[model samples]
Target: MTDAQLSPLRAEVREFLRAEIDSGAFTPDVDSWMTGFDPTFSRRLGERGWLGMTMPTDYGGRGRTPVERFVVTEEMLAHGAPVAAHWIADRQMAPGILSNGTEQQRRRYIPGISAGTVYFAIGMSEPDAGSDLAGVRTRATDNGDSWTISGTKVWTTGAHIAHAMVLLARTDGTPDDRQQGLSQFVVDLPHPDIEIRPIRSIDGQAHFNEVVFHDAVVDSSALLGRRGHGWQQVMSELAFERSGPERYLSTLPLLRAWSDHLREHGATPNQRVTLGRLTAQAWALRQMSRQVARELSDGGKPDVFAAMVKDLGSTFEGDLVTAIRDASGIVPRREGGTHLERLLAQSVLHTPAFTLRGGTNEILRGIVARGLGIR
Candidate 1:
């Protein structure tokens, strides 16, 4: 169906968000998908059948198309809803589990994820490797029917409160084996041998963490996908991860706040032109992301296009923060300030990570180059 046919669904999500705001359930903020962690709000999305729009109906999902899920996700991020609680699970883990997880794993995890009551964390980065998934040093020892993992995963997003974590480790080879012998596991959180230590950011939030597995044992069933196939699995997952609306929309709240302020206080012609250009750029980026969703739905792997979206999207995100503040000439305040001031403050602090997370701009550029057979 064309986007026009999805108008009703889009309107419904907007209305629900309207009701949420009217009831004082949340105050819209910038980069909500990254920073907002309201479990109650996430549960409310689950109750509305909005959490698992693309998973199988057999697993409690709505069984909708990727485009439909795209519509819902675009709305949530644009409106700055508190979706961080279920973001990872619903966005990537559900599809990962459905694609490679065993039937028992699906039955046990999918329903709670669809219900928004269960959360997951990404355990890909290690202290030594950073965003280089291939340089992983975290190793897991095979013990017949189970494995004993003994390594640390750094920058583990949302591991503390997560019900489970999807971790990557070197299972059958040494760290020198870049992409070989790597495997994934579904490590249940709060395990006796697993330690979660929070890492605070410049914004004073522990959204990132360090997850150390001290000979932690997991049944062979915890393995995700096939042994030594994690490189392939994770590469595909990054295509999904990088091309989402979140990439371009992280600093949207800053624009919204500034625009709202302009509506009240008025804007000069130059400001109007700048805002118009930025808004137009955002619209173009949205269309690009939406096309990637349609491609994924059609069983196409547009990783190259996904990389473009991420590379340009993150640049847009960081530039947006600078543009809004420069256009207004208003000082950003960290606390006890106007809505625009506070939002700008948050955006300024977060701008540093815009190009770093998911993958660095340098790495993303190389992906694009390699995709074109230039490297």
Candidate 2:
């Protein structure tokens, strides 16, 4: 896992991305993992055994190292390839299923996930709670052999197209119970009683959605992990979500665009200095992210470490956008602009979300403070 073994695979992925780009499959984009959803490309990766890069062969995964998977994802984000379709499922869902899913659940979901045929949406945030699980009011009423879910989930990315969702519900307690009485479920999508509506972001993307469960019923087998262990299960999954390269590399394609512009149009000395500073910060964030991945591979609960990476990485992402915007002096246009201008437009609009998803910067700081015994 620690060998320079990543080199060959990295080269292979780069070649594939090059070919895809050369063939005009997609335009390079900033934050492509979130905004550039192409299921066909995702299935292409699955065919190459790149989607579930770390799961075991038993689950139809490649059994590669987490660091190795990180290498692949890093390349994808850097290229601005369309990866949104499988990003959530491959990054968190696969690992979450492996960590807490039953054998039956694993058999049913993992193979499809690795094949990029199945997609999942995270049903964590609510209109009131945002990403705060403590404010959750979604209730799953137990109906003997079945559970009836009735509630609303907001900011649910890709719910409109997902096959299922990993959701938390209040199964046995009131709001005062906080962490207790919360349970997780794997509810299938497109059910008659379940409704989904898109929420357009400032960038005019409709990937996020509001999902309403109106007494949607699922069998007892829908439960994930232990009963009333939703908090623990979700916390475990965040280790994968918050520490990845996507946290920082969302703006890299834009930076690359800026770099291209500078190379073609020339830059002042100050602009060169700015580029150097940004690259330095990007490298530092990459190192911290890699360390978190290594710690996870070694079976350590690096929750605080992950929080630090996420917080800093998101800051870097925003900073990268600002630096590029100032240096390029290109008026952003969502449509009919030069390549750099268009990339700048998207990256500019996406900055607000950098510190919001995967837990806000405020929440991440709280995690670090508590984990470090900072009183």
Candidate 3:
């Protein structure tokens, strides 16, 4: 689709975000984007038909292309809206389910997801198996038509508020092999056998959780794709996860706010040079990320290039936050109700997680190096 086709939707979303900002639904002072979590905000976006624009129409989706969805997502992040509540479900689970789920699964789960009535958490990274996908030991035992699962998942974002979890586990681990017996399951978070405890970050936000699944029974319908396909499924999902604007743009509001502050205060010579450099870097990264999105929309696996974007984008994020703080020569306020103070505080706390989440920067660089035959 042409850029023109995406512009109108982008404008429409911008208007909606402006309205939300005007109504005091959220404060623009902080990275209003990442600091808040409101189900109502999500449901409002859903009601506007902006939540699941890429899914099919039958399951409460709008049947738009990835590019269309990209326009909506980019706009939401740029406005610094509190989209974390529905971000995972919209970005990864919905697409993964649609790609690998049965018709019944889709019919049962996706409509609520599209409507923003349902939420999901990812149960991938465990306490012992942070970056190692092949090391997950969550056990899913076969019990005729259903399965019983038991394990712990750490750093699970929104588990306390999520309706379900797209989990990875070992269904049939044998002594000879580990990857041979992997699977993905949709475990209901509110089930009696499950527990979710908030793991507050350094910023004093309980955005992450330690989730324990004990004998959580799921029917056969909960299985996604096929048995022993977790490796391929997780890889496919990461393509969508890593290639998005979220990687670099999560900190956009902070950068923009800093830029605005610099402009309003009359930029000095040093400030002018720093601003130009940061602007160029942000612009180039944005273009690179969009290219990866184009590849994803074309149904091509942009794994190698996507890894590059994630690695570089993460570095850019850490560096940007540091540079803005250093160049401005201003202490990030911790007490003010203004947007700049909140942005500074939130960035100081949340920026470290950027390199750790999705995939660690080290892992991403390894993939890129291998793809270049540099190993």
Candidate 4:
């Protein structure tokens, strides 16, 4: 569907967010997850049938298309809603399962996910491997009925609060095989052998955690797909990763809030032009993202196109923060005008991860280049 077609749903999501704001479900002057974790907010969203709106209705999802999902997500981020508590679970893991999981897996997991009864974290980035997912040395040894896993994953977002993790480990052969030996498993994180230690970020938030898996036993059923096919599975998942409106829309609420504040104070023509240009760029990026969602819904992988969206989306995200700071004359500190202060603090603290998370800007450009047959 076109952006024009998505307008009605966007309006509906905006109304939903307005109610959340009125009820004080989110703070107007705090970083999304910095203050603390809030499960009640997630339950509220789930109860509204908004949590897994993209999954099939048989599994407790609303069965909406990705375009509709995009509208909900975009509105949430644009309003600066504190979705980080269930962010990785909903955005990455749940979608991954809905796309690639078996019927049993879906029946077992998706309903709980939709009900906010189960939460998941991603176990992809490790201490030694960061973005080089192929270099992940975490090993999972098969024991006929289950796999015994042992390794450390850094930057495992919200591991402490998560019940399970979609973990990637070397399973089949050797690391030299690159894509051949890797596999993805859904390991229960609250087990006795699994350890989770919070890693305090510069923002003074412990949302990120270092997870250690020592003899962490996972059932054979925990394998997300066929063993030794993790590279392919993760690649497909990245299409979901990069295609979402979150890639570019996370900071939109702050930008708009700042813009409104500046206009109320009688901004100059230059400031007005800057805001207009930024808003226009954001709108264009949103359209590109919606196109990728359409492609996904049509049963085609838009890998190349999704890469382009992420590359441009993240660049625009950083640029949006910069423009807002410049135009609104706000400093990146904890104290400023009340709303501007919160936005500046959030933009300052979270902007650094924009180019690095999901996939790095460098990696995305390479994907685009390869798609053009230039690499």
Candidate 5:
């Protein structure tokens, strides 16, 4: 959608957020995408037709373009709205399923996903496989009527609460084969054979999980796309996942809070300059992200470009936090602190994960290098 077309929708979302905040329904939070999970808020967004704006109309979406979705997503992040409950399902899983799932799978999952009633978590990262996803040791064996999946996944965000997970397992290859013979499965969660344990962060939140599947049996029909195509499917999905407003907006709430604090307390000339520089960087990155979204809408992968955007956007996220903290001259406190102080504390705790999640900067750099034939 063009800027003129998007203006009204943007205004509509901003107004909705204003009303929600004015009523004290939810507090604006730093890293709200990851830590601020509110199912009620997610359902509210779905009711407004904001959760699955890009999906086809037949599948309960608004049949909007990615650009329209981009407007709503950035606005939500900017306002620090709690979107964690439906973030994963709406952002990538639904798209993935639509692109690579069977008709039965699509009919079964898409409606609930668009309605914001179903949630999903990624099952790619393992204890030993962080950036090297091809090295995952999770194995799935065919059992005629069902697939017996066995292994553990670590650093799984929201797995404990997710209704299902898009699990990647080695169905026909060894670790030596890297990406070959891998497959994806839609595994329902909270089953008797699956165990979920919390991995607490420095902030004492259990958003991340360690999930173990001990012969977890899922229907044979749960396989997504084609067997041995899981790597390719996941790569396509990451292009969608890594190149969004979320990459740069994770610390936006903190940035806005600090900006307000400066406005109230007065900032020095140097502080103003630093804030301007950060704002410019964020604007440029947003343009880059929007370009990627447009590309996805046009059926283009733009993987390398996506990786580059993610690398730079994540770096900027960390830099934004540091710059805001340095300029504000307020020490972050975990308790009994001002809003700015609390947001700063939250930002500091989340800084390290900024570059790590959705593929590390180190891995992203490699992707860019290979794409440019630099390596």
Candidate 6:
């Protein structure tokens, strides 16, 4: 659908957000999708048919198109709505499952995900394997009807609170093979053999975790897609994860707030120029991200393009935060501060991760280069 066609949906989401904020349901936040863990807000979104918009209607979703889903998601992020509780599931895991899960798996997880009653965490990154996912050493051994898994995953977002995690483990082959023999399992959380501990960020928020699986055993049915295909599956999942409105919109609340502040207090010509540049960059990145969403909806793999979008989008997010800070001359204050000040503080604290999550900018550029046969 065209942008004009999507205008009503945008207006509808904005209205809902306005009502929610006016009623004091929640405050707008910077990086809300990562830091805002409001189950109630997520459930409200599900009730509004906003959570699993692009999934099939048979899976309890609205069966909407990617453009439609993009409209809703961009609105949520732009408004800084608290959406983190269901963000990973809706954005990445649900699509992964639909593409590779067994029928039984679909029945078990998709509906709950659509209802916002289920949450998932990613287990692709380990202490030794940040962007080098091929270096992951988590091991899983076959035990007839089950697999015994043992290893530790670091920087696992929301694993402590999630219902399950899609863990990547080496089930066979040598590390020299790199991507071979890696497998994914839908390991349910809170198992007896699993321990999850919080990893606080510079903002002092415990959104990340260190998850250890001590001989944790899961049924053979827990395997997602084909065994030994984890690398391919995960690469596809990252395509979904990286190329999203969230990448660029994390600090949008601050941008909006800064714009309002500028209008109210007036701005110097230099400040106006900076704001214009930032706004133009955000607009361009949004279009790029939308194009990737269109490709995904059409079942096309635009991994290289997705990488480009993420690389540029994340840089834009961090640059936008810095521009806003400099243009407004606002010192970040954590507590007892104005909305703009609080958002600036949060954005500044979260800026370091913008280019690191999903995949680092360096790794993303490498992927793009490889795709172009430049290396």
Clash count, one per candidate: 0, 0, 2, 0, 0, 0
lDDT computed for candidate 6: 0.92
Per-residue C-alpha lDDT of model 2 across residues 184-279, encoded as one tens digit per residue: 999988899999999999977899999999899999899999888998888888989999999999999988888888898899998999999999
Question: Number of the top candidate by lDDT?
Answer: 5
lDDT of 3 by residue, 1-375 (tens): 788977888888888889888999875533333446788988988998887778899988988888888888887877788887788888889989999999988988888888888898999998888877678878889898999999999998888888989999888865146567889998876888888999988878887899888788888778888999987898889887887888878778887887888778798898889888988998898888888778878888888888888888878888888888888877776677667867787788787788988889888888889989997
Pairs with steric clashes in candidate 3: 29-339, 33-80
- lDDT for 113 in candidate 1 is 93
Candidate 4 Cα lDDT to native: 0.81
Span of ten consecutive residues with least summed lDDT in model 3: 27-36
Clashing pairs in 4: none
lDDT of 6 by residue, 128-239 (tens): 8898999889999999999999999988998877999999999998667799999999998789999999999999999999999999999999999999999999999888
Give the clashing residue pairs of candidate 6, or none: none
TM-scores of the candidates are 0.98, 0.98, 0.96, 0.94, 0.99, 0.99
Q: lDDT of all the models against the reference?
A: 0.90, 0.91, 0.83, 0.81, 0.93, 0.92
Worst 10 residues of 5 by lDDT: 321-330
Q: After superposition, how far is residue 183 of candidate 6 from its true place, in Å?
A: 0.8
How do the residues 1-375 of candidate 1 rate in per-residue lDDT, one tens digit apiece?
797999999999999998888889998888888889999988988989998888888999988899999999988988888889899999989888898899999999998999999999999988888878899988888899999999998888789889999888899878888999999899888899999999999999998899989999998889998999988888888888999999999888788878888899999998998899899999999999999999999988888899899999999999998888888999999998787898899999999989988988888899899999996
Deviating ranges (above 4 Å) for candidate 5: none
RMSD of each: 0.9, 1.0, 1.7, 2.0, 0.8, 0.8
